[model samples]
Target: MATIKAIVEKSALAGPRSIKISDEATFSLPAGDVFLPAEAAARVMQAYGQAVNEKVLVGMVFPARDEGGWGAVLSFAKEGYVRDDDAQNWKADDLLHRMRVLQAQSNPVRKSHGVPELDVEGWAQPPTYDTTMHRVMWATISHKQGEPDDDAHRYVNYETVALGRDGHLLLGVASHLAAFNQSKIIADGLLADIDFDNGKHYADFDKTTDHVAEYGLAALVVGVAAKKLGLLAVFLAFVAKFAKIGVALPFAAAAIRRRFKKRVPARPVAAVTTDRQEPR
Candidate 1:
């Protein structure tokens, strides 16, 4: 088994928010406050991956090395209250299904562009980090082609959703597809180490004063209320588009030559001159 070292730091999000991450990875912060308004947050997130309509409180990317190929990225977003219907019976499987559907829709687009699609090979909900505070869900994706050869070559993503005491919904997503099992350990550790100020945790919810959300846990996964795609879809689409272009350009050039042959006009031959008087 591998050992991990934890470092607690001020969250890139707003006040009273802090996070913990493994010391092995280097963290990158957005230029400004990550908790920008919905539109601003969406734009900022796009710079990292894709536009997410939700109000992002903070976004951080942990690159395994200074050179940046693979590592872990995390984001915290705010959703309105949880709906009564969904809160009662929502399960991690529901989120997994939603993710699968999104993958199916996005995969073909990626392949068409020549980028390999990541397949969701497995998923499971580990024991909750804090049963009274949040519900956790996780899934693993197939490794990208050409990734470093390693025993733990796989991609894993985790989402922790909780209802804040103020009747607000909070979501935390950790995406790690490159650093093998190292990222997995980091993600789990981060969740376990999360510390929210008083009146912020789910256990602080007040039934009398707090308002109920129109949607529930299911809504968080499927976005029933917003009826819009989540950040994962947007991020995947962005990656596919760029990856396909990079991967296909060379092959596309070759294919183009086969389809349309450009005839180079034959150059006129220069008259030949002989050093001897041409034997005339």
Candidate 2:
């Protein structure tokens, strides 16, 4: 098994409210509280972009390929993670190893089979990266809030595409989803599959206890969009209309009359009013 080691440090540009997840480390920090190593952060963000792109592509209005490519990728990823040998069949792990060997051997003849590289630009964190990191962080919060089994939702590592010549990873731009469907992660750690090695497995390993953090940041984005759309619709619908107390007064009065009826006597209401006005 190829071991992956990753480390996270602190960055001034990354705010205290900033959260980051990478192939090496997952970060949840207050401004200036923590920093993640640049490479690992880029790798994680890249993978995250790919993952989000996959979800979006599968759900696209006009999908590129109709031959169950999404299912094929998922099955392939799962198989590589579990399988042991090539005689049994081919797998992602096998491919990853072969690629690593090619990288190590420096065979320009087989350059096409080498490992993929990632390039992240300055900003623009993708929703998946944010969501995955928040999930881990919130899972921790939920644990603190006394939720059980909240630690089984963590993500260790994932696969993502390499940026172009600039080596920039832009979470905001639409990427080629077909590429992601072909890429795969070497290995991953899920919250449900937590087995602490302290320092035995990879470089970024830590002794901290795991937790399940659920962050519905995407829902928040959707909520904000819905609210904005609603506000825009209302504004457009009522645009160019003159403000009038004439229209507002009747509606306000009706509301007040309803409140008054709730407090008035149910029976003989007219008689009570007549008696009150009986020259008293």
Candidate 3:
């Protein structure tokens, strides 16, 4: 029977993160195997390591407390694998898959089972994404290590919400599991790092946690501003909801031209003779 294996890579920067695999290969023949390619793995692994490291480092720096960090992370990650400026942005789905595969090879139990464990030998192809939003990944790794029931694994799941056309907020929730689901990893250890919240606005700290709390708080804060400022915020919000068409929005039936009210040049009236003679 095939067994699961996991592997980790050594790097100075961000990784030592592993990928996991659940099965073994049938046989080894030519060097150019479809699934297992030797020469390409080194490049793929480097890219994968960089992707994971950046994701984690950015989160740590921003810290996701008041939505500033979370929002930044979302904006950075979801802007396509390559940006308009032509910089490469690693797609989340591709990175997630690579991590899973790499970890599988490093599982440590493959030797005892006599199965062909790939380990984190390396990666062949770069990651590609199907879509930018609505992604979920789950992987489980079990290692006895001569300890009683030493089954340990981790879960990293998150979703991003785009607000209007301008901004986005990301909510990345991660949890670790050891010995089945008997314990809560977030509450016990990871709690301090994340500072998880049920989504409350700072201005309305007194209010109870409820649906749309952030929205309500924003509205309330805007309401407190002087009338002109408050109105501007409300108008900006409204404008963002619609598609940007031209210099002026075509919202109402009256199509007010952005340039001059009327383009027709004024007719030059006959100049009245300033020095009008006594008798015309």
Q: List the residue pairs that clash in candidate 1.
A: 81-213, 83-215
**Model 1 C-alpha lDDT per residue in residues 79-188, reported as the tens digit of each score:** 43454333445444555456557766766656665555554444423212234445433333444455554435554444444445434323333334443244344344
Question: Order the candidates by lDDT, highest first — what do you get?
Answer: 1, 3, 2
- Per-residue alpha-carbon lDDT of candidate 2 for residues 106-168, written as tens digits (9 for 90 to 100): 323223433222211111112122211111110000011122332231111122211111111
TM-score-best of 1 and 3: 1
Q: Which lDDT value does model 3 have at 41? A: 25
**Least accurate 10 contiguous residues by lDDT in model 3:** 1-10
| lDDT values for all models | 0.38, 0.20, 0.21
- Per residue, candidate 3 scores C-alpha lDDT tens digits across 189-262 of 12112221232112222324322223321222111111111111111222222112122211232222211122
Minimum summed lDDT over a 10-residue window in model 1 is located at: 1-10
Candidate 2 minimal-lDDT segment of 10 residues: 136-145
Model 1 alpha-carbon drift over 4 Å, by segment: 1-49, 63-76, 83-95, 106-118, 124-130, 142-153, 167-180, 221-280
Instruction: For each candidate, give its TM-score against the true structure.
Output: 0.49, 0.15, 0.20
Q: Using lDDT as the measure, which candidate wins? A: 1
Q: In model 1, how large is the Cα lDDT of residue 169?
A: 28
